[model samples]
Target: MPEKLPVYRIPDFTPAKALSRGIHVADLQAHRQKHAFVQAPHKHDFYLLLVVRNGQGTHTIDFTLYDVKPGSVFFLTPGQVHAWDLSPETEGTLLFFTPEFYRGNREADALRQFPFFQTWQHPPVFNVQPNSLSPVEQLLHQMQQEYSRAAPFQIDALRAYLELLLIQLARLYPKTTVASEENIWPFQLYQLETLVENHYLEHLPTSFYAHALHLSPKYLNELCKQNLGKTTTDLLQERLILEAKRLLTHSPHLNIAQVAQALGFEDNSYFGRFFKKQAEITPEQFRQKR
Candidate 1:
């Protein structure tokens, strides 16, 4: 049997009850003092941000190890498995908030506007130069201070600070070592990814994504080809296959038919054929190996 993955509900930490109010902040040092375990694999019900101001270790997310150093930032979207890799002396700020927090108290903005928030398509780690992180640090410090105090309109203040942090990080994202192809996806591709994120379960066709992005299927294919060396259908299948793999690997109680139904396939036999075509194995076989 596969090891059961640990899934955490909202407010993973003791102080995270504050997260229910919209935003919460904690220091790594305080966390270590409160709990005997410093690092264990876990997933969150909300988004998470960690900025390592002075640290040297590895932060692993979804089986990928990202080097942790001063000015390193980690972004974790909901459902991502992550673990801390730091020492007792390591120091950093951890922030948690839900999607509702983003839409509350202001005009709604798409979380997808930031690169790091798009964790499925992008690496969740960013290595910012120390000299360039002063403003970012100032914003985080203000958020921490506000979260700790009884200031009026506290959620408002936290929201402003969080928005600033996201904007600053988004600006730095394009300058990072992301693959050249990632930078070239174009606005249309960005919209396509957003669409897939929302509607992949519908089992929609490439034309649906093309129409939503207001491009013809040919142009969509062209854009994908130019940026990712893949066609629109290929990209869409990649997203669908990814979700299928997630269900197959994690939802052990679900039978193959249930997995098919959950992913919008009505026919178990059809789903089996589709999975085999894309994954080169039966869903059961894939789950066993994983």
Candidate 2:
């Protein structure tokens, strides 16, 4: 079997005390120099917001390759595998924080409110216009300064800046149907997406997620369709197919049957048929193409 992908937690890079508070800010190039291992494909347990002020390269996130350039901003949620190769001159800031840190005294679905952070709805990366990049750069620098000072109530100050930064970026993001005070359905949809992420490996049905959300399956499907233009089953199947592809492409040592079993498919043949139906390609073909 292929070795399991490395999963990094905030404590891996930050001091133990910061681990409790769950936030880290760093100079992008300096951080990269200090931790060369991050250049390899790996997963993180905390959320990451990386802003590239100047760079030239590629950042591959969950199999999608994005250009790494000036004004590029990348947001990564927990469990999304990514690796990047930036120029030696790359300059930017990286903000790492846990859900708990961002959600302190806020609603449970706070982080999900940002469209970019909702990977199911939008891509994880966006580029800021040079004219508009100044504000964002300032916010990042302010956060870095506050993080280094360790002043009293520093956590509160950092959290406030983080939210402001998210707000600024949201404005730059392509307009979409985002959660708002007048609408609770988007929040519910976010909850459902989160549930799917946590339970997709189990191959749970829509009814299971519906019950967990205290909504009927039919209504849940309606919510999904209205917000995401997809049914609950479609969401679940897509999540399964994404993970299957990830395993097939990254874990070359694992055969088809092993990948199927890893994804909770008891029968390799059945897994093959399911994969082809959803991905429109055989597992071997997909693996070879990748």
Give each model's whole-structure lDDT.
0.76, 0.86
lDDT for position 203 in model 2: 84
User: Residue 36, candidate 2: how far off, in angstroms?
Assistant: 1.4
> Evaluated with lDDT, which candidate comes out highest?
2
- Model 1: residues >4 Å from true position, as ranges? 1-19, 32-42, 55-57, 84-88, 104-108, 129-132, 174-185
Q: Mind giving the per-residue lDDT tens digits that candidate 1 earns over 1-290?
A: 12255665545565445545566778878865775443776667778888888868888776578888988888988767677767656788878788889778556447866778754357888787876888888888888888777878888878888888989887777554344653543767667776777888787888898888888989888988876777887877776677677667667778888888888888999999998999899998998897
lDDT of 2 by residue, 1-290 (tens): 24377889887786688533488988888889889999989899999999888768999999889999988989999988899988999888888999988888876647887888888878898886666778888998898888888588988998899899999988888655455656544667778888988889898888999999899999999988987899999999999998898899778879999999999999999999999999889999999998
Point out where model 2 deviates above 4 Å. 1-3, 19-21, 176-185
Best by TM-score: 2
Clashing pairs in 1: none
RMSD of each: 4.1, 2.3
